[model samples]
Target chain A: MTTVFKRPESLKDTETHYCSGCGHGIVHRLIAEVVDELGIRERVVGIAPVGCAVLAYEYFNFDVSEAAHGRAPAVATGMKRARPDLIVFAYQGDGDLAAIGMAEIIHAANRGEHITVFFVNNAVYGMTGGQMAPTTMLGQKTETTPRGRNALGEGAPIRVAELLAQFDGVKFVERCTVSKPRNVLKARAAVKTALSLQIEGKGFGFVEILSPCPTYWGLQPRVAMRMIEERMEEIFPLGRIKEPAAEG
Target chain B: MAEKHLMCGNEALSEAAVAAGCRCYFGYPITPQNEVTAYMSRRMPEVGGQFVQSESELAAINMVFGAAVVGARAITTSSSPGISLMQEGISYIAANELPAVIVNVMRGGPGLGNIGPSQADYFQATRGGGHGDYRTIVLTPASVQEIVDHVILAFDLADRYRNPVLILIDGVLGQMVEPVEIAPPPAADLPAKDWALTGCKGRPPNKSRSLILGENELLEMNRRLQEKYRAIEAAEARHEAVDAADAEILLVAYGSPARTCRSVVRKYRERGYRIGLFRPVTAWPFPSAALAECAKGASAVLVVEMSAGQLVEDVRLTLGPAANVLLLGKPGGEVIQAGELEAEIDRIIGLHKMKRR
Candidate 1:
């Protein structure tokens, strides 16, 4: 019997520019798989932000547009409104989404633009050499926070999913990780829910994926995966923060 | 046979946009220019086009950005304060080289000035209104009919050069009713945009974007845009030289003030004064060449405007200081009446006759 695991057609065969053990590749593959399964490959437009996934358009076969740092939501808003028939998504890193683009994304969601957002939360700015992010966990060590993040000085990690869930225009909101197979499946489901909400014209949809950057974290791929499974999940927590309440 | 109907300048622009195949209008409510939004609200749905009243000017202009990327003939209209709020999105649209139409019904400014007409935004409109080195093709319409005619030309010029075109009208023109002959829509053989956000349907994918981050890359992008601007200036600089042929004195003005100057010219001509008018149609790549030509024989030039002589500086540059240029106008929401302008012209003419004789 042949194992049927394969790369999705929505992703090109080119190798990514990410460092070894960086979870960007996995997240990219997951998004590609979702795009493929939904059969919206040709009609999907992705916005690459100024973070680790800034060059994500290089890997995604569909049409892609690059956005200025922290302006992906505004750029995506423009794209979706101009081409309403296209499925639009923004792939952003933690720093890009939470730090600089906070106003843009919040305003976009508040306006209920019909677009899906795939936010990657790795707790650090990977491409810019591991700086602390808004989602950076307490006690996390980064170039900016060399002595580990302090709750008093640096503030606590932001729970974006929980925050976004409060907006009325948001149709779905969830947080998931890619460290384990089960978690990967849940992340895929979250992506599907977001896309489904967009297709139904319900409103804005967001899925934050807890990805790992082993090279930036100074760990091996397996070790990073283990850290995510053992510690990251405990802090980030999994499950849908907002979904339509089922009728009793 | 063309049909003439009485309409406000704002309504004329809306009709002209529809005739020009504009498919989307996104704007917020503001005074003096409310007619453009209201007209679009009624007209857009009739043609299966999209019309949205955005929560704010920021969102409305961003919506214009979105619509423009998808190859839609999109536009937004606002007064000075609202236009200031839209500067960010306009810069983005300019950087991307997306074709869009923006109408600024000039009102008093620097803050929430008033609903009254003022040319205070001359610097903002002629110069790059937003950050970055970009120029919009600015057209000043002095008449309600030209408001219709120029808006149609604005859309054409916007797409022809793949840049934003501003129909810079004043509150008086936007609100005042005048008879206008609405021309038939342009010929059917007009070109189509394949790169617009009409969806990639049955075609190779298209990408519309403006994030040029790389230093060398952005430089090259701007260089290319500069080249386009140079070409646009070469081909599209237009102006009106009414009665300038044998005049020793020339009057320079634009927009509604230009109409007032025209009336001044008519009254002074009847009084045996050899005065002429030079009206700039393209305010940005301004009608400098024509003004220079008209200034050759004139002993002096006067710029009449609703603001503090913004275009007078341009006249000085065009005339090279050989011609004595004077500015007669009011600022802060004051309209220069035709009688005031005529008195100034007569006094200048009388002074010139005394010196020559």
Candidate 2:
């Protein structure tokens, strides 16, 4: 028997510390694969956000920088501007991007900085132990919203992809889920698309991956998939919301 | 042969930057210094360089940080209020030990000061405006030509020391137009950056950053930085002392206000007042030796500034209590007239003569 799939060279051989069945590991592998496929592994610089992915530098073989919480876009902007030839990306979680870094990410896209952004939307804060997130789904139960997220009390879940799609500076914007094997493949394509946009010298490209935190979601791998498939997709429909127009 | 051209102080700085091999500029629009950005915007594209108008002062400075990380010849200009917004990125640049030039065509300020020539930011520029135990080499350019030469020198010194250099001009110098000879362009063999993050492909992943986590590591980094600062002090301290050989009185000044004092020096020299002028070129390392030398046998030292005698304290530190130091300043939006400065000079001379008699 032979395995057709192997980890990308961009990813380190070290084991991930994420919970078993966590989608972060899957998304990380996808990003690494994209970086390798695009041949940008050596020229790629990754910015790790202040989240569970804080130690993302340890996992990626490429150059990595740690940014203050919610300031990854600002850091990425600096990295990209300083070395325009290098491929830079930010790996951020919902709590990091939507909660604290909303302004930074929005402004980065609005400014149309030529870089890629990989946003992981897991509905709840994973590193801080299942607290409420800006993207936490309504009626979803969490440590902070124990009786379910009350819309009137906690406000509504933020749709980052939708918000960023409105900005003219954003060259590419897409949302995909990693709840199942099919959607995982879709996410890989999305990641590739975003990276290719940057490679083509197009402005800001973003891919929002709806991921799952099994331990925090208090569900098994299969049950989490059901949650993502049934509920997450309803909240965040998949497909490209913005794409660069063909120059005639 | 060196070429001469007529230009404003801001245009001279921009032309000199191009000649000095600068290829990138990221800045925001601010008053009294819009000319710097406008000049760059017109010249950069023609030379295949980058000129970006960043969204805010915060974004512009960070862009400078980005460009500096990769060893691109980059700079940004802003007025006093914008400079305040750039303190964080400036601190980051210093902490990382990246080489870049920053032009602060300063205006009056503690907050939102008008777009006029003022030395209020003397303390902020000289004593590390940002929150960090670090220092930036600040150059005060009084004339349009100095602004041009200093901007080019700033890039060289920044790269030489791998530290940020601030070209501290003021509204008067920035807005003033005069005859300036554009320096010849640097040779094509300008220094190349090996530490930049330009694709990390040829190198073994060069990591140029400022994050030191452990206490011991942080302390060691600080010590190393202090050593670098000392080396910079020894290597790049610059000042100008005029007609101090047989002078009885010395006038200490810097920036645009120093230009006013230069005129006063000429007038007093005609009236038989032997007053010399000491202009600090590098405001950070200052010109302590030059100031000390100028005050050697002088009976009195006068500090003329547009601020509330900020540089006076620095002069006092250099001259000690032996010299009778007096501050002649016109703070709060009033320009220091040459006649006012001359009167103060005469009064000081009259008082010293009375003391002797």
Candidate 3:
């Protein structure tokens, strides 16, 4: 019998520590599928950021380095510049990328470091008990935003995909979500394009995955998916925001 | 020996690092260590190594952390305020067990002090500047030639112990031009770093991190670090003494102040005063035992520093009250004049003789 579905060789067999119904797990699987498809699993070195995905190294079956909070891009820049032979990528969360590590990510992209960055924006700080994040939507109630995030008190959610797409160093930028099967397929494709850009010696590639956090959003698993579709997607639209020019 | 040439201390260090097989440099601009970043920006590209001018000192150190994870010979340089920004990354590098060289061309500080030289960072460098109970091997090089030698030594020791090595110089040593020999790269027999993260082509995947979520695991990690520090302290402490055995007055110093103490020792020796100079090359392992040995016949030990007696604390810790430790300190941005230091030396010896009579 021909097997149609199986775990990617790039993903380990161990169970993940991510919460059930979380979008991170789905996004992780998509990245693994792309890594296997591209046949670049052995030459890939992943950087895990300090957030919900801090333990991502355990699940990715390749060389991985755990970065300090918000410094993954800087780390990836160093690695890629030194090796250039290896495929390097950074897995980061909203707090890790948009908040404390803003300077690092901006500079890395501006410098045109040839690396892939998979940014998961769940809108709430999941591992840190749902504290307000940089991408946290205004009027959303979080641990720090107990009375609901006020636009005057807190800024509006940051559109990272659009912000990063403006840099000349960045060659590809996409925003996708995994709230449903149809969207998951698009996200999977986006992951492939981002990784492929690096393989093609293109500059920085950024994919913002508008993921779901059932535990922090105070909704059922299915309902959390709906919230991503209904609310998060409003601020973070899903589609390719920027793409490298087609080769002749 | 390579050809001798006139070189500034910061530029010589950059050339020495390139010769030492340094493969990557990530840095930000900060005086008086700006020459290092500028020199590396030019030299690294010429040698086919990578150089990145990071957005800030914090980013530079993390970039060093990244290069180190891949087993590259990575380095970063900055002055006092910039080094303060680097403390967090340094702590992470230490915990992650990465080999990196951090050069702090210290200027006067508690703030954006000045571009002038000072040794006030003694306590910060020696006492694990950032958080945690870890230690970094600190090397205080006094002159242009010594800075070149110590830059190479810093890299070797960093890789040897799998810990960060800090080269602490003040603005004086960082900028002054002097004639020095830039040597060729030695045939270094460094140990194999089997732990570096270079993709798992045919072997099991490698994961390197310092986050110990388990309390017991963190305890074990701390214990292992302590053991390694003990090993480093025993084997790596370096010091020098001139006529220490026959001295009644021992003047101890490091970095730029040591250069001044050398001249003071010569002037006192010409006057037939039993004086000697003790300079600690490696500040973290501290040369404590070696210093106690050098102070054996001395009646008084004076620590000459650019700070408020920071280095004197370590001397007192090594030799208690009987060593009669004195301080000839210049707080923050100024250097100690040779005339003042000489006068202090005379007072220390005169007081010792009066007490004996």
By lDDT, the best candidate is: 3
TM-score of 2: 0.88
Better candidate by DockQ, 2 or 3: 3
Cα shift from native, residue A160, model 1 (Å): 3.5
Lowest summed-lDDT stretch of 10 residues in model 2 chain B? B183-192
lDDT tens digits, residue span B245-284, model 2: 6668888888877888888878778777787888999988
User: Quality of candidate 3's docking, in CAPRI categories?
Assistant: high
Tell me, by DockQ, which candidate is best: 3
Q: Residues B1-357, candidate 3, lDDT per residue (tens digit)? A: 678889999999999899889979999998899899899999999999999999999899999999999889999999999999999999999999999999999998879988888988989999999999899999999999999999899899999899999999999999999988877667778889888888888889888998898869999999999999999999999999987877788999998888888988887787788888999999999898989898998888888999987999999999987778889999878989999998887677677672321
The per-candidate count of clashes, in order, stands at 4, 2, 0
lDDT of 1 by residue, A18-107 (tens): 888888888899888988898888778887888878777678877776666677776677667656788888888888889987877787
Model 2 segments more than 4 A misplaced: A1-7, A13-26, A48-58, A65-84, A92-104, A122-157, A177-182, A211-238, A243-248, B185-192, B321-323, B354-357
True contacts kept of 2: 0.33
Which residue pairs does candidate 3 place in steric collision?
A: none
Name every residue pair that clashes in candidate 2. Answer: A82-B66, A82-B67
My TM-score estimates for the predictions, one after another, are 0.87, 0.88, 0.98
Return whichever of 2 and 3 wins on TM-score.
3
lDDT of 3 by residue, A164-233 (tens): 9999999999999998999999999999999999999988999999998999999999999999989998
Pairs that clash in candidate 1: B70-B196, B70-B197, B71-B196, B71-B197
